[model samples]
Target: MPKQNFNEKLIARLKTNPDFVDESGELLPAAVKDHAWKLNHDLIKFLLSDPEIKSTFFDEIDGHWVFNHNTFIDYINEKNFLANSYTQFRNKIGLNIDGKFLPERGEVSLVWPYKDCVLEGGQTKEAEKRKEIFFNEILAQDEINQMFDPKVLTNWKRHTTEGEQDVTDIQRDDNGTIRENLIIKGNNLIALHTLKQQFRGQVKLIYIDPPYNTKSAANTFAYNNTFNHSAWLTFMKNRLEVAKSVLAEDGILVVAIDHHELFYLGALLDEIFSMENRMGIISVVNNPAGRQDAKFFPTAHENMLFYAKNIEITELGRLSLTDEKRRDFKYEDIYGKYKLNGFMRRGDNVRKEDRPNLHYPIFYNEITKQTYLERQSDDDIKIFPIDDQGIEKCWRWGRDTFALRKAKYIEVKKIKTRYVIYSKLYEDEYEGEKAKTVWNKPYYSGQTATQGIKTLFGSRVFSYPKSPYVIRDVLEITTKPGDIILDFFAGSATTAAVAHKMNRQWITVEQMNYIETITVERLKKVVGKKVKEEGRLLEDIDYDTGGISKSVNWQGGGDFIYCELMQYNQAYMDKIQVAQSSEELVALWRDIAENSFLNWYVNAEVPEEAVNDFTALGDLEAQKHLLAELLDKNQLYVNLSEIEDADFAVSEEDKVLNSEFYEIR
Candidate 1:
């Protein structure tokens, strides 16, 4: 039997990384790896013409490798030879009555009109051909080796670094569950790119509250603050592209933005989701505090756009209560658990091919009290077997179903080709009216934060959180129990906390500082944590007046793994360029090793035996240390050095020909 595949998602992920490269600064080989399409791992294995690519370019410690863009490009082209492979595929398809020969350079073109007829990408052959060429060209370009729009990458990385942001990393626990919580940092561009694997066609619902691009001088929008109209639109556009992929066959995509970006976002949504999936736009009155604007109408309403992947004539029920409604609701089991449906059974409305055994209904024999259902000739009628009771009631079901339904069904009551089905309820049964185009629910109404916080947590260390009632209301309506709820703009983790309380896991990512008092404090109170802490986290989150100070200043407290996104410094890169000899390189490394802000405590010692040429330990003063065992050509050890004195302790030993060891350093 063929084994299952896990590399499918990983393969898809590799297709997204343009800057991914080998040690020589060339494009990385396209192989199965960390990122692959969901389930494709079974179909394809991770491959690499050169498997040591990561160590070559990423590590940069190996001196044998040199960064050369042109050479790397050549290698990528050679490695991607299959992309240029072409073979005729025979196909039989349709044409118009007079035969429609599409025009040259039509917007769309067929990939292999013979084997598979999948319409995707664009319509023009020229366009598709151009795409093929462009894709190959993109693969061969050296631009990928450069910083990805440096300013954008830097700002995003800086904003979403470990301590500055809170992003939950989750994955599907089982295939049965469709929903999952995802929190991604870095530039949303890169983050979304990575998500193509796990989420393509798998997301059931998406709700994004993006920045509204309102360029109001007094509005005050910034990196960490909020987005102005153009900025927000651009950001949303990039993120939506990936979000669209995660949606399921019957999935939905929703966006939350104010008037500033509503019109534009609506247009963009139409482009990606298409007008068919565009269920409708909802106007939410979020703010009760009206801005008294003298010049224009004060901005108040925000848009909640809804879209679904597919629409069908599904006879869904109305509400969960009511006498008349329950009457319409049918039951099949003893406990009334198996509700009966009125729709034509799977075969209700069928073509002739479906009911081959069905014939015209026959009348019952009143005098003989015998039933005859199937068509019979003179001889066949005599053979029409009689029931033991001598009363034959003609069956209403088709001939083929007579035996099957007879075996399973014990009809208690029956009407003219219909049963007492449970569906479509009256207004009286519901606590409120059925859903309307306008959502006037308390969640949408806003201004309930104080009450909700007090109810969920009585002044336990947090305040002014979103109402879980509202989040629950929306989830009950639009989402299933298994769906992933993403709140990138989550204030106090209201959405996630609500989702969790409802047994729905969620991902909450926030960048505000004094996080303990804001998102942290709220989550602690909301999650109803049992563990008590020694000290407070960050004092508050609303202190920053703008995006950030650019110096990677953290304004919060509490225990969190401290880390910041970092890259090679240009000045250091220049110094490395000038150094041609190993001695110079060593000196350069020494200078950087001593000067960088690594916050090293020299007394830390290296460990006994941790990794090759390295060890973790505690030094004389009892600080953490990392020791590396320097080796010679025959793999002979030379000396041990401390990499991070505060992190590890180090010791080295000399070994004999037979692998006997002696303490060397």
Candidate 2:
């Protein structure tokens, strides 16, 4: 019989000890506390009790059996044995120089220790059956550029109100700028890099709702967790680093996340964008009723971490006030309906010592109901901005501000013995109110998103789709009509649809097979063309009435280009995924060996002896998985420079489009 893997062997050894093993024969975490070097004698005693373990793991030295603690720790921490599989290829793929793992607070910067490959996160179809490929992030500086070189785009088609048409040639403006909106189907990390060549520092807004890694939510060591969290951070860091380069100096990045990885994602963002550029964290009540299965407090909200590329240059848009908000301005005047606010500062740093310049007296003319920065008359009452408790406080405005706006905005009111200075807050002054940190609108709920999808597709085709209104509001505040918006994690293409309706150019990328069945299909509906109605014989020729289309008065009339990264080895990888039997897998393996670019560590020639060893495994899944590991991840797609190469079988039409897309002569 074949020997059990190290994980199996470790479990069996642990089961021999009643103190460590539970009734289910699983190792109790508490029993392993003493396993650390010099922690306690319990682990040593337990190991000694197992004769096989003691013989295999300990060595006889100086009349006593010596335990190799380092080896044991390595065995325990090894990727295969550890709970997270992300570190499985650590020996082959070393950490990138820039990938620093924040293990703990105040800890020295160390290599991120985890690696991400092309398939690190893209496998959303039959998620359980997909095998992952691991590769070095930055094997060498020269090699890294090759790994991220722009890839050739295929399947060029423009969808618009008229209909879909093959895009033979791309149109560019006087400055050679591609004005078409885009939707790319491929791995987002690679796509982001591909976009870096053309779109660097051009995207106005990037909004993403990436995977929360909710499985690891229970663990509180979010920033420092070795397995799942580390892997997640590594994946995020790779993409975010590239994403930052693609953003305009005054651009904004908004990431929607829940409680699970909030702190961890926040820390990572702080490291990348610097905490100084962090704009605000908005709490959106996407589920008003709250999640029923929550362990403690029912979660009714998720947070959006907003950051500006350069805070100094960033300008935020405003929202029109509702009728209810207009009521807040209670008083009326020739200027507009207004409200009175005391000029005295109320919050922290209100004392005269904090702002001595704002502590000066304001002389009030009671008869004229006017205020001045200086003494107008000897009879005029001087207000020092004192509270009822006899404590001094500084005015909200300085003397310069008082002089600049006192004629139009200041009003002095006398009540009993004291004269009070007030600033007239006009309704027109706040015609467009700044968006607050909380959004509890009913339209922002996840249910609204679900219902919208149902209206479009007649069923809930995607889960947790963000309400298009949410994207609409987000786009409203961050971009203009022609600004470029990018969403790499393009679930259901909500951002793209909203951007299209709002007249902003957008680019969204998705790797899931559903991108065809759901993402693009949804976009097609949003672009709107003649479609057969369910109840009538006539085909309705109109824009999609669902989502933000009606809200924005969108009678859609625009176009977007849909394309994908030209697959090279990725095509063979797909065949590997669907190969049913051992016979099919063997045939695919032979083809891969002849045509594919094998990984750096893999030898092209399979030794006759190794073939016998592989056959002996007698497992189809195992053989298929082993075959997948041999393909080089870096060559998943054909690079743009290699379009002329006959080996990749690039079509003549694709060559023309590629040349035009890249603006190459």
Candidate 3:
């Protein structure tokens, strides 16, 4: 066959094969195409097992045979094959709409929309904003790598209940796991990449309440929250892709978002993690009374999307019984609290004909109130599971189950002429129950969260702080003590504080200027101190009493290491944003032109004509924006490899800590 015709012939053969259809009767090719043509290696292996398919692609080279991947990929790309197999299959399955333009209807894959571009998301401070960089602008991987190199960490301090101490070295456990809880201040995207060097496949759980992109003051993020829909998606996509690499194999990720981007976020996550790994979406009623400004429906709920790094091996934790749930256990015994459950089946497959084996008779003694699978004496009375209408029903358990736990667990009761068998359902028998999809509780309310933060900070310094109870419950259900939990969007340090109180190692990163004022201070207070009134200690009480402190018994004495990504050109950007007038910006521009690393496209000489043009723009904000853009985004932070360079003023203490953090010699 002609080399070009090889793919056409192979596609024709695959179309006729019945093995291409899955158990659900969906074409496997269609499913694969939905996922950007990234074939499931297992399915590829299985398909190659067929002699007809194997012989067509496998070529014997010397002593071994090699499957021609390019030829197979070409076959999968054949338009006629996909149109006939995928589009027709969707239509047959009732997924098509006459007027709708579904993304899947096109030849392009779902992730292709943003795949060809990269958003710089270079906003390192609250005032800075992102710039889009197309694939064509990105010359090579080397350039991208240079921009994302491991950053140098400075200002390392270990905080304890006693006081803060300079940290020259990182503490690691016997297994070489970093023992210190960490709070790093920088751009979260860059911070995540830095963390991946040491924490790849090490985090147990990651929970982030990221920017909702709601275009409202209530939910605005510090790193420029006014991005357009596609820009917002690209921003999230860049961070989420890195976040996935940092997750442990069995780690769980939970993302909190409002309705503004819920559907789009879901689609993005599906593209990144695949649908098979998706756990479920949880609806949390954070606003019980609802927002008054809502146009139609008063919005009261936000969603949490849960996913696992590998769903098959991910083990979920259970939630403790609520007061309402505890009420169900009405009876108590020496063993513990328990309730009576009907031994007879009440739902589907309850009919005797449905499960004839379970419909067998059981002997019951009225005096003893005990149930037996078989009669022991004449006093024993035979009973059948029958309803009031005289319809026979099957026992919930089969004969084998009844015989196994008949003495201790099964109980027989008599009321009038009818006999009922019950099973002792002990509350202690189960550790706890799985959390439901909807979580509506008083403690989960937004007002409660605001009040809690006010109590901690003496005022509400932050907007919409997440409730500590929410974070506590998240940790309780998803992690064990000592497992690392990460929250890149660590607003107000709620995740870190909760993680510390719950006994999990944590890492939080924030880029906003408020990280020092609010985020770190919250964590420092979490480590324990007496409540102060006007900078004076009110009492000898050594631990915080607000939020979940009493619930988790957090008489906190833990500590965390705080550090910052040493700024390079980012310093100039900060100065530019703070400049008040055109004269000040002009003066700042002079300093920037001499000292800062400018974008490759920006002229280095600070041409007098260009300076005159900059002055002519009279608008201070416009001048500031232009000056900020002139600085190179790639050199925002000092890279780890440049720590020894004297021009950046690398302190000896910072160099030691940076080496220890990155595990470099």
Candidate 4:
């Protein structure tokens, strides 16, 4: 059997301990702790002293000497070694980093102590399997499971959409709401991963129109056009894991896709959501580029593949205009027997006994008191039945049914019309109107085009995006009222707007900052004007500004602290070092980086008590304040002391390395 991995025990320890990545666990990065790395080769040497761990697990493989640890035994045994020399290994990781093992607040990913690999595709099968298993271990680790409780996130109060929010000159909403409902600006992958525990199986609906797989080929049928198919798939897969987890039981995930990756995407979705609950596709017109100017069939239609949690069990409801519905629901036959259309049309042989008048060359309508032929048209001429006493005149229904229809018949003479044959009229479950096989809905050009088309439109008035009318028609038959709607690809945030208009509270998530900017602007204009214009989006007599639309109690809003992820790049540090003043620091790193970096999650504080009590990253805003305190205290002397003692040497081999004494006070 192979030796155990360090992570197995580490993960086990973290689950029970919230500060698995903080002081109580692995110490935070010294840069974050306001210090430098200390050299302690003694610990490194001791770690290497484990002859068994070194020789077997750390042997050279794929030209790189990396350890492989997968089994529980490997973990337990290493736990024994680390326990025996816990201080040694811990010090080894922290060695050359001068900071004391200080606690940091907040929850953070604990995938450190991991040496990143730059060379790829050369690992042994054993090594590959080890990495895969280790990755899974990290994802399923105990501390991660303890990060956030599902019930807690579910109970977090939704902000009111009313009142004065935290709008300022720097972060003001365009229409001037204080702030947004949520701001997640970090790597979406990291954000999604962090949210898995708290949101799993709770989101009602998810609509993501991710980038398409088309970098390898030329095709306009795509979403994100920059990455390769595999890259796009990988990016989407990571988020899908969280998105899937976030869904409520009666939820759905609607992905927007064109012709390019339709087949591939369909397969991917099948894998994600099992084939069992996938309903048929709703073909939508996202654009109007038709066959008019094409060499091939127009590919304007998009597939919004609907997936229901439990179709029969879902709470679905709908209300629409009854007048617009087709009226050719029932038709009467000429045989005096009320016959139906699209039924078996059974009358094996024309029986004279079944209907004595069925043998007539023409049937006379007693109501109109006029002779009628095959079928009646809406013409003023009083004419009737065209008959050769052929198959058309055969009694389609039982005589018993014809009598029922005749009893319910109400008619006036003067106009020519067929007499009511009960089977053709009041027949149970008739296949009513003949539906047209082709739907001719066209995709209008995007608003950017329309606004430009008319100079008077300031990208505002009549921002009438592709209406909710389209999605409503598709959903009315499929969804009942109260089902949650979602739109991750919310352009102008109209999907949720439409959902609200149709009595559904929709959750829309937009990843693009510019789009978010535009979303806030459009929402302020539309929702505000809508309230002032159409009252509110509520159902109750007094309940105005429903959850789906803008609300009155809204705070303008609460505030969110922004943060960025730093991957320990030397250049990042260099930029920090070169900064001359606080103004420069704010401008160069703090301010710009906030908008540039993606956030993993937002919380009042990272839950690790000891860490929170120590480090500021645990409380981002607090962290910045602490940095101010650190500067005022002028603990620069301690940093100066650290730089003096480090083993400064230069190796010609790694020439691109820094040769300066960076651990300055």
Candidate 5:
């Protein structure tokens, strides 16, 4: 038999018992208290096979020896020996120098929830069926240790337009309210941490459409740039951990991904946001007619993993009724347009035995063509539930309920030989329906997303922009009119445009060079600004009008600030890349020593005064080599800790702006 996985509820119950210990005398503290281990059916069977272990954890219940939670935790902890000491596993994939790995300072190691689960291919058939137990190995490592290290945010500037006038330094509106919307151009990983300084625990919703990392060269939508499995996992792991920090306790996170990385991403999310906090997985059929490149089953849907910081406080908004749904109320009465809905209970456990009180009969008067809960005379015809296919069913209401509400709700119709009963479901009394997990909305298609960008920009500028309507729908469900929405991946700024149209505050970040050309220009058109594309007005271009501006009746007036990560190492790298000769390289090396600050991690012993010694070197090649060794190539931004340092030269004007931007003062 396959192994059964213990749920969080069972784990919680196990922690309450004090006498829980395994056959090997190991305590259950780690597994029960820290969620450090999980018990599967196979492992449970193994324990039961041993008399000493079985006696401790199993109890006879109704002829079966059921596994006890207290004993199970103890048994698993003994089988997998865990220690409090921090230890380094060998660098199998070569991510570190000298084949020795060290955990980043303050990194917490998570215990593997399952033991002896083989994840790699070529396991037994039964083991292959137990994929969830095996998959937790992918998330067994410590959380990305270097995630929260401080970085710099620089090149701050606000961008807005007032009736064809380009404005830059206007920080406040006419009423002096600080602008809430922001468009950041930089590495999203660094930008997320930067935004956390001001917006942590304040943002209500986050919708990120990150790189799918589908390794198909022919796939236009794939990021094209590929990372090995481990690298991809680390990249997503680092970003998601920080993203979770910025979310409010009641906030919702919606991520869009395809099949290629769905399982891995889901596992990573399980580790970051404990499995208990997962809201649901929505399957959106973006391409109803399956893609041609699919090998086995033609792919038609993408997954949207929705999670809440706290499930108790999370509530989703409803979707409005469509015209087709409204048309269901075809019949009219004095009350309103009404529809005939059968007054019979259907589906599982709906028989008389299930709801005995609701199985009563109704009386139909042949003369007046009216139904009643009570019989008036002997001539009155009695009716009972018999479905269209002639199977017996039960009435939806009890006798007392039918008696009190029959006059207003019950309707009678005469078939050839019998009477049919229905309840008048009125259109005026209809509330919106709950949003479903399967989304087949018309506007979620990739074609719609493409046309939306083309219509706004007068050409195809971005690859695979999400439909603004889809974003609007997400916003409508997850946010109120004044809530804040963030999209760090901000491709084509669709989330920002939708948020602006929906009257919600928004923040978006993009790392591409097209931020000025495509993302900013799209928003400009959204705000009714006449954006010029190559010296021509976008409004003059002939294109189909199906985007948010036309649908929302947007006239447009809002402001957003644009900024970039302050360049330190990248500036020097840029100069080095452009140097034409050895003399130019020598000059560039001198410029870097004067302008940039070296990362403290690079070499703490090297003092700032020692920079002069390198610049004094006569050999050009030696100068280049020494400068490369001194600078930390990975630390692109100036550290926040070094903002006040003399080498960074942060002016008084910048210090005030930095403080104001972060809302720290």
Candidate 6:
């Protein structure tokens, strides 16, 4: 008889014994059930036939079939297998949306609308045309690595007294030690990785207010071109992974996010920080009145996700008591100011049956007016928790606990012939209230954030900047003086300003053009002895010194180093920016072709002779424009490894700096 085919034999065996596959054990590639059990046989066979899919997703270990975790994720992403229903794919992989399961979804991909579009597609034809003309291209792994590879921190200029005053002497502390505060101007992800060379595992606190990506035209803070859900997740994942590596063992990460991506960000955090290290979510009400443009209930609050590198060693700080809280401790005694607390467990499950051990009675001396934990041979007097309303209550502490710490409790007075027992909680013993989950106070609102930036710059240059007070409050709880604070999304440098005022070292990174106009200017103002407006120190104008600057006694003395990421493609870009006419731009294009290394991902099919062909085009302006567009803007920074290439002339000084910065021989 002829041997049955693989699938036929497997199906017959499966019918006889359901566990015939032995999924947990090693099996040869021919006999292995690599695809999900629910998948169609034809689909499985088709996937296995594709060389890329088979080689990437399926592996052989000692001639035994094995699955490649990361490659499988890539395969799923490339094929859009989970496009129809995520729940179906998740169930097949034994994973839920929260990333919890017997086998976790190690990597994830969201269904982006325009992800798998081709030039010949129906709806994507216009987009394909736009790509042929001008559109952003996502950089490949090699291109991204080469573009962001470590470069020297050059053009080190320090600001001390504002007014563009450059101080050569570094400011030293009382111990004659000089601390460096950094303001980096570049892509935050690349900057963070570069910073890792010197700051790995040294940062104490990281507070970031990343772009909310609201995808609303009304939201001015959103990026010009909205990143799709999948791209946004990937962007955050890359940065957060690097951020996690730079945090000290007991360090804390606090991210401020809105309702738009809060759930998605939370899931990402869960995957990165793990459930055990998640501290808690704090709801901060930045808009009490609520935003008016909502389909349902208007959003009034944003969430702050807190996580620790090592929860076991992490210590939470407390907030100082307010005047209203101080009034509660009115009574004073030899033990100092104390508050009388009812010694009964009055909330849910307060009955005798609820807590049998705490149901025991305490002895009260009617004459001495003192309560004792135990009854002295039934002669000392008994105090049962019967209120004036004739309701029974239970003791706050158990019998053994109350016996050991009876000095804290006292019988104060008799009310309607029944002795009233109380516990004296002293003021000195109380540090402060633990920070609550909900922050609805007026100071935590967006109005305060606006007022803060206005106070510093005298104009609202940045939209929706975070309040320095709120950042200070977070720092007070998570970090101490002299701790290193980092903020990669330093839009207006509010985190750095707060850190400087609080006497902590800080590093801030910003990529926008306003880094110099808004962020750097604000930091200079923070260090200024006097506020300036219109390039002149203002004395008559009533400037509102409302933020932490005044309270922290900030003066123009401390210094911060300012640096920009070295340029590669931007050098050609500079020429493009300053081109007087189309002819000059055409010449600059030829210069780019010779000197600049184009990103491999940027229309690699375009012939090198296209530059010469563009010059012959009748529309000189269009030819110039297309030439400028041909270079990828994303490959702006020259990799340190490529600095020595003949195309990029490396200066000896910069070479030394780059080598030392990366600690490379």
Poorest stretch of ten by lDDT in candidate 3: 108-117
Q: Which TM-score value belongs to model 2?
A: 0.69
lDDT of each: 0.36, 0.73, 0.73, 0.37, 0.62, 0.63
Per-residue lDDT of candidate 5, residues 78-184 (tens digit): 32122211111111112123222221111222111111122233323223311111001111123333333455555655544443332234354454334567887
Work out how many backbone clashes candidate 3 has. Answer: 0
In TM-score terms, candidate 6 sits at 0.64
Model 3, residue 562: what's the lDDT? 92
Residue 466 local lDDT, model 2: 90
Candidate 6: clashing residue pairs, number: 1
Residues 80-180, candidate 4, lDDT per residue (tens digit)? 33332222322332311223211112122211111112212333321321110001101222223322221101001122234223222222234322222
Off by over 4 Å in 6: 1-136, 161-179, 217-226, 310-315, 322-340, 352-384, 397-421, 426-428, 530-545, 549-558, 571-591, 600-629, 632-635, 638-665
Model 4, residue 462: what's the lDDT? 25
**What TM-scores do the predictions have?**
0.39, 0.69, 0.74, 0.43, 0.65, 0.64
Clash tally for model 2: 0
lDDT comparing candidate 4 with the true structure: 0.37
The candidates, ranked best first by TM-score, are 3, 2, 5, 6, 4, 1
Write the residue-wise lDDT of candidate 3 on 335-426 in tens digits. Answer: 78898989888989899999999999999887877777789789999989898899999988888988898877887777787888888888
Q: Write model 1 residue lDDT over 396-453, tens digit each, in one string.
A: 3565655454323322223453222122222333343354455544444444654454
Candidate 5 deviates by what RMSD? 14.7
RMSD of 3: 15.7
lDDT of 6 at 227: 31
- For all candidates, the clash counts are 56, 0, 0, 48, 3, 1
Cα lDDT tens digits, model 6, 1-665, are 22234334333433343222223321112112223323435534544665544564578789764555455443333322222232232233222323332112223211111111122322321233111111112333433434445654555567765345443444445643335798887667778777885677888999998766554422423221213344466668878998998899999999999887888899999899887999999999888998777789988988899999999999999975555677999998777997888887788988777876777667877666566766655456777766567666678888777777776645456667676678778888887778999987787887898767665666555656787778978998999999889999887788998898788999998765667887887877766655577878754322224576665655445668887777667556545644666568656756776667554423433343444455444443334334444564445666666778766666676666556545566
